[model samples]
Target: MIDRDALQGHLQQLLEADRFKDYGPNGLQVEGKREIHKVVTGVTASLALIDAAIAAGADAIVVHHGLFWRGQDGRVTGWMKQRLAQLIRHDINLFAYHLPLDAHATLGNNAQWGQQLGLVADARFGDQDLGFIGPVPDGLDLPRLSELVKRKLGRAPVVVPGDGRPLKRAAWCSGGAQGYFEGAIAAGVDVFLTGEISEPQAHYARETGVAFLACGHHASERYGVQAVGRHLEVNLGLQHAFLDIDNPA
Candidate 1:
């Protein structure tokens, strides 16, 4: 068992959470039990995840996406009330990491996704260096790379074909990062992958001859929190569980 503040401090230091101006608070969004023993990690801290954690007898819940966000209604009511009440009743510590979880060199969402796809990252780009540029395997074309992504991520990505060239290099930023497509193009990658795609991205891909792949936002970001959970188990001697509430988006 570890003190809740100590756990939060360790994670803050580990992920360098304070360095990024994220959309929401990065650590300890809600305070509960003072001592955290078994930790439940998930991509989001929805009501379902909280119930599951409660069922699992968790003392703390860690997630990539927490309940609170910037520009959200400050009042705690409705679904938010339900989630907060449950956590409070159960005395479960709630911890969350946002951009930090995405940008961490080793235990980040982008890094884990790249590792899963066997892509070796050689450079970083985009806002806060969240984007990764890497080389694709020899002679790997857009179609083949799409298939690889589908197989690994368990969802068929929406592909916008480029100039039908064999992809030499690829760049990616997970979770609704289609905004970085142009930056990836500027970085001279043959293909750009992200969690979501907008209408303009298709036109950009067609014009620039840089392939675009829209992997599911949730699918792309599922690994980082799990990686952190395992890290806690190994390095901090804390019991951890990753309860995935399936999200198709």
Candidate 2:
């Protein structure tokens, strides 16, 4: 069994909430019973995942993406109504960590991807503090790496080559970050990978001479939430299970 306060506190300490400027507040939201046993972790707090958690008899659901966005209204209606209605009915607690998970050196999406694809490169691009951007491992080109990413992430990448050069330097943010065009260019990364893209990304890829790949946002982010769940199960002696709610993007 896990105490809610203790678990939240441990996560706070480990995730370093103060160090990250996150899209959502880190730590527990929608508090429930003070004592917990079964924990369900997932990428997003979508309806499917929440339903699974309730069915699994989970006291709490930990996720990378939680309910409520930056500009969303406080009113509970429509899709939001259904989601909150289900959770409140079940008395299930929701906990989310966004940027903290992305920035975690050992357990983050960017860092884990960095280990698999790129060698260590000091953990940052420049003044930007959101995610990892660096070089691919030795002697590999873009096409081959794209193949690997397709295999691992189970999706074909939408590649846009800028320099038409083989890739070594690259930047990555697991989810939708088509907005980071300037950051990747400034980092000197020859390529960039993200889940979603816009028209401007195409223009930037052409102009900046940086290769771009859209590899599906949900696919790329699945890793971090699962890793953190397993870590919690091992280190904190909590019963944890990861529920996969597949999304194409």
Best by TM-score: 1
**Candidate 1 TM-score, C-alpha based:** 0.98
147-245: candidate 1 lDDT, tens digit per residue: 999999999999999888778899999999999999999999999999999989999999999999999999999999999999999999999989989
Model 1, C-alpha of 249: deviation from truth (Å): 0.4
Reference-based TM-score of each model = 0.98, 0.93
How many clashes does the backbone of model 1 have? Answer: 0
lDDT of 2 by residue, 154-221 (tens): 88988887878767677887787778767888877888887888889988989988989888888878
In model 2, the worst 10-residue window by lDDT is: 119-128
Candidate with the greatest lDDT versus the true structure:
1
